[model samples]
Target: MKKKWLALLLGTSLALTACGSNDDDNAGKEPAENKETTTAGAGDAAKIYENKCSSCHAVNLEGGVGPNLTEVGSRLSKDEIEHVILNGQGGMPKELIVGDEASKVADWLSEHK
Candidate 1:
């Protein structure tokens, strides 16, 4: 009957639409390796800065509540930068960044300077 055929067609269309939507959640997620790459290693230091330091230091590190981090390497050595990130200085709190992340950001700032 026409009613039966229309009902089947509508059901099939709904199922297909639901299946297509299921991928939307995963579309926003990077693969595991890419996620790790964004948070780890030499290349990811800028991403870490954007996540943590950009708020205070400004997107380009031109300074904000914190001092301009642009060319910070020229002002501080890598070890000094790492020490500050771990210990904090002045208005900044200690451990704004910690562990290997501290070292990576320090390395990045120093290199940019």
Candidate 2:
């Protein structure tokens, strides 16, 4: 009985060890097309909006903690929008995004209207 228990324990340990090796084996080898797709998705304006502004502006940009920006383009020019993004207004914080990322987000918001 003891021998059977020891054999069972040994088998379980080996099985668990084998399972853990597969994940580490694939960590460093992303395909080029996959990398391009991921990078594109990361920089896309809509994705950026969803990640950064959705919480305050609402998922559809219909407004929530912030005013509805659905027609912001009509209300503000692209430069104005960029200014606001960099400068903030009222309850919003300044410099929420910076540099090229800020410009991309601003351009997206300005065009959505």
List ranges where model 2 is wrong by over 4 Å.
1-41
Please write out the lDDT profile of model 1 over residues 1-113, one tens digit for every residue: 99999999999999988877566668977775444335544547888888778889999999999999888899999999999988999988988677778888899899876
lDDT per residue as tens, model 2, 25-94: 6688786444422333568877767766788999899999998999899889889988998899988888
Q: Candidate 1: misplaced stretches above 4 Å?
A: 1-43
Task: Report RMSD for candidate 1.
Answer: 5.3
TM-score of each: 0.62, 0.63
Scored against the true structure, residue 70 in model 2 reaches a CA lDDT of 94
Model 2, residue 47: displacement in angstroms? 1.2
| Clash tally, candidates in order | 0, 0
